[model samples]
Target: MSTSPVHLWGPVRRAENDGVRLAFDALTEGAGGEPLLLVTGLGANRYWVPDGLCLALAQQGFAVARYDQRDSGESTRLPPVATGNPISALFGRRGAAYTAEDMADDAAAVLDALGWGSAHLLGVSLGGAIAQRVALRHPDRVRTLTTMAAVPADVSGLATLRYIRVGTLAKFARLRFPDTADGAVAAGIAVSRLLASPSRPFDENAARADALRNLDNGLHDRQAQSRQIGAQWSGPRIDAITRPSLVLHGQDDPLIKPTAARAIAARIPGARLRLLPEVGHELPARAWDTIADELRTLAA
Candidate 1:
């Protein structure tokens, strides 16, 4: 089934930390309710988060905000650095641009700009790893922590391979689209389809719509992806995350294995885990209510 088109909560706002500028927006001001910050997956823009999901969370009394990570979307793109083969960089020792710590601080910068001292963290995939680091680095800035389809923060190198689907990575490498605007949209839909569950009849409608709105095509930049994936975390382990946490995974996810979510839940004390059947790497419309309900409960 197709989902609704993306809805912009407000005009894009800027948040600066160190030298990097972040682009963010909120559906709610978060005055009388909990402020929720959404962190999307690797190379994904804030628009990647569906409007229906945000509305669902708003219905549950959450003031939700989503932002573009560094080098993605309207955010500042760092100077080009030679980060050879994104996969090689994934298991490398050093980042070509910045540290993962810097990325975590970006989230806090967005919170500061919004005038919210702290907010609940909801992250997906690479976003989930950032959320975990944010909680560890800035505990006071996080009320609750939730990670979806993410690997553990501390696990890297050969150990990380255990939780990944190598074939999926290969498929990502094979994706080809022109540099044109229409190409960006096509690339976006192609990537979404690859992440989607094989059991479900893939619908390009929602993906195509989001692609049209978020035409930046961050995914096509392999070096930028490398910098993001290569950034190492030297901070506290996930076990140190004391905030109330929830780990959600799709049982049928083809990109990241279910074990990745389990590993995260196991690392964080008292973190709850949920494996959704018939789901995939992409958050389908059918799972929006359940995700909202879980977030509401976690915030309470």
Candidate 2:
């Protein structure tokens, strides 16, 4: 069997959003295919998205790009404010830094920087929520929307908790490591292992390599994660999204429940929902091609 082209990631580029600078990188320089932006999960750097998935999508005729959201990775970090705990912040009414609308605008800014009029957006975890907001806030700039292992954008407070596995979140507090580059790698591996599917063998080697390569992984920043989760959305609901939408969630996802995806797909008119069995919060290498194929069909 012929293998897919290995996507060579371009150097990190900057996209200015207001005063904040968002960091992003394209799959390669000259693919000239459909633009597809991959939004990373909460506090995750662009490297969290597997290169294998990007390669698979590239083979399917997508010019893939991934970006670090505000307060994550190389993106501009706002001054820290008092955010008790990230878990509490997830249920908080006010954001310590910015609104979710501002976060959505950041995606538009990246698109403007790339000079793409509109592009398909594929987001996972917290990124999925941001992608939905982007579609609602900047409908004209999105061709299609895909969310993986995400909750409904409209739900918040106690309502949001219904879709989350509280026990899994508690594990974040238990993660203990020295505050250093090596610690970041260790934390990354712990988080990755925690989110990996129970049915599959966790790839600690690959995770270690990725963590070492992207030493700026923001897994240790609880307050930043707080600000990210605490950012409230005042815009139209996910049902207001008019673009083509797909909601994919892992059947065995230990973070957000598959019901969250179902809720999203049900709310967004004509949105397709796919619950991958034996999968988890993290994207396993085995499911890369299947996801890419689904995205290809969505773009078509």
Candidate 3:
């Protein structure tokens, strides 16, 4: 099924943090209702939320806002990798460093700039790691939390395996390719092929289109990806979070194993976990209805 084109309404006044000015798109059904803030994963722009999912949430009476993180999309870019290695930085060795807490702070700053006291927060993959930190660090700013395909503090089992594979691949890519146009194209092709696998349940045309759009948008800044990767490797402790939470995962996710979701749910007190059998790492456009229904339930 095809989704209606997304209608974005903003170059809204986003707060500046850490030498970066945030940019966000806000969709509201009305003035008085629960607001939902979406955070994207590593190497992703706001569009990664998917038009269908955003529209679904809007239809469910939520005022949703999705933004480009500091180094992705139209947001600011950090200096090129010079002395510090991006891969080493991820493992907390020796490099330019920023924690998921810092990212969470950025989110809070966005909320402040928008005059929102509190809102439901939803994040996917690395974004989920940031959301957990946000809810833990700024408990008052988050009403409800949903973490999709993320891991908690201690990395073990399949989550560790996935991280090792992704980190190693990313490191190799950065050292060898280093953001060249050709590298971007190659990466896009690889991603497209991976997502087109039968277990992924995605539209190949749309996947390719999104991949090329991302490349065209220059969304693969190495420094930003490095910082984000660092945050994910050493994520925050979620045990302190008291907010009602939902953890969603695809049983067939190749990148982040389903057990990671179980671990995340285990850490957050009383957090609910839902596992879908066929979905993979990428959130399919067809799952918009399921995502919307889940978010609505969380908001309620």
lDDT at position 174, candidate 2: 71
- For 1-300, candidate 3 gives per-residue lDDT tens digits of 113344345445557787778778686443255788888877677766676677778888888887777767667666654424445555544334555566888899888877899999989877888888888888999999998877774453244554334743453454434476666655655554453325754555665666555562333455667655655334446787899999988776666667788878988999999986677666775567888799889888
lDDT of 2 by residue, 211-242 (tens): 77767547878768888988988989888899
> Under the 3 Å rule for N, CA and C atoms, how many clashes does model 1 have?
0
Compare the candidates by lDDT and give the number of the best one: 2
Candidate 1 clash pair list: none
Q: Return the lDDT, model 1, position 154.
A: 82
The C-alpha TM-scores of every prediction are 0.95, 0.95, 0.83
RMSD of 1: 2.1
Candidate 2 lDDT (Cα, 0 to 1): 0.87
Tens digit of per-residue lDDT, candidate 1, span 124-221: 99999999999999999999999999999888777888999999988987877777898888988898899998888887886787788778678677
- After TM-score superposition, the amount by which residue 174's alpha carbon in candidate 3 deviates from its true location, in angstroms, is 8.3
lDDT of the structure predicted as candidate 1: 0.86
Clashing pairs in 2: none
lDDT score, candidate 3, position 116: 91
